[model samples]
Target: MSDPWLPSLITETPQAGFELAIKLSRMGVKMTQPSDEIRKKLRVIYEDDADSLIAASQVIAINYQTVAAANNCWR
Candidate 1:
């Protein structure tokens, strides 16, 4: 099955992408939202120059500070 969280980042605007990133980060997933310049770089690396291709963030799995908390402070 596809990842449910994928839609939260890609199917919406930049602000929503930011929120999703934070939410995932709180869950210990380190993610980075690609800026315009970074998008250009990714296009180069992936060699996908499609105009409709949206840049996806790089998510690294690891234990982070936010996830170490006993409670969800983001709420």
Candidate 2:
């Protein structure tokens, strides 16, 4: 089945991504560096506006959920 959480991150905010990453890390999820282009996109989204932080947080939460679900599914 397709993961529902992955798309949520794409739609969420950067701060959300950070928060989600933290939560996932606590749950033993590993993180890898995003590509330069991806990083550039993230920077553009976050650096340009303060209100976008909420979206960032949502992205993170979705990412965390995706990771957790994937791990569980594999196990």
Candidate 3:
């Protein structure tokens, strides 16, 4: 965990920024869980759950907001 995946939040475009946000969200989950087997088991439970899906989307949206702000809204 010493290496850094987020050296900077800057992106060339909004699409890339959004992708980064998704990556950040995913990384957050991995950091929290840190177990591929358990994550897979949990994914089976949450995959078809609409509420869980929406919650995941919300986390991505929040991460996007942070990234967008860091990029100055790409303005």
Candidate 4:
């Protein structure tokens, strides 16, 4: 079976990765990877420039909302 986190990590755009790491951090989800270097990078991206990260999240939310509305799934 494929590792579930691999898709999210590999497919994420830079903005998406920043937003996702922030969300995961807020949810108290700790990193499980063995590589401390990768974890440190993720932490830096999520903690640094947090406002920009949040803005990216807002953009993603808006895009999803638009798509759902277009599909009549908003109701």
Candidate 2 wrong stretches, greater than 4 Å: 1-50, 73-75
lDDT against the true structure, each candidate? 0.40, 0.53, 0.97, 0.52
What would the per-residue lDDT of candidate 4 be over residues 56-75, giving only the tens digit for each residue?
A: 57766665444444445423
> For model 1, how does the per-residue alpha-carbon lDDT over 1-75 read when each residue is reduced to its tens digit?
334644323423444445555567534412343366765665476556443232233331221222322123323
Scored by lDDT, the top model is 3
lDDT of 2 by residue, 6-71 (tens): 443331454555555666543332234436676666667666676776765566667666655544
Model 4: residue 34 alpha-carbon error in angstroms: 35
State each candidate's clash count: 0, 9, 0, 0
Model 3, span 1-75: residue lDDT tens: 748888899999999999999999999999999999999999999999999999999999999999999999999
Clashing residue pairs found in predicted model 3: none
Q: Over the full model, what C-alpha lDDT does candidate 4 score relative to the true structure?
A: 0.52
TM-score of each: 0.27, 0.34, 0.97, 0.35
Report the Cα lDDT for residue 37, model 3: 98
Question: Which pairs of residues collide in candidate 2?
Answer: 12-55, 13-55, 13-56, 14-56, 16-56, 16-57, 16-60, 17-56, 17-60
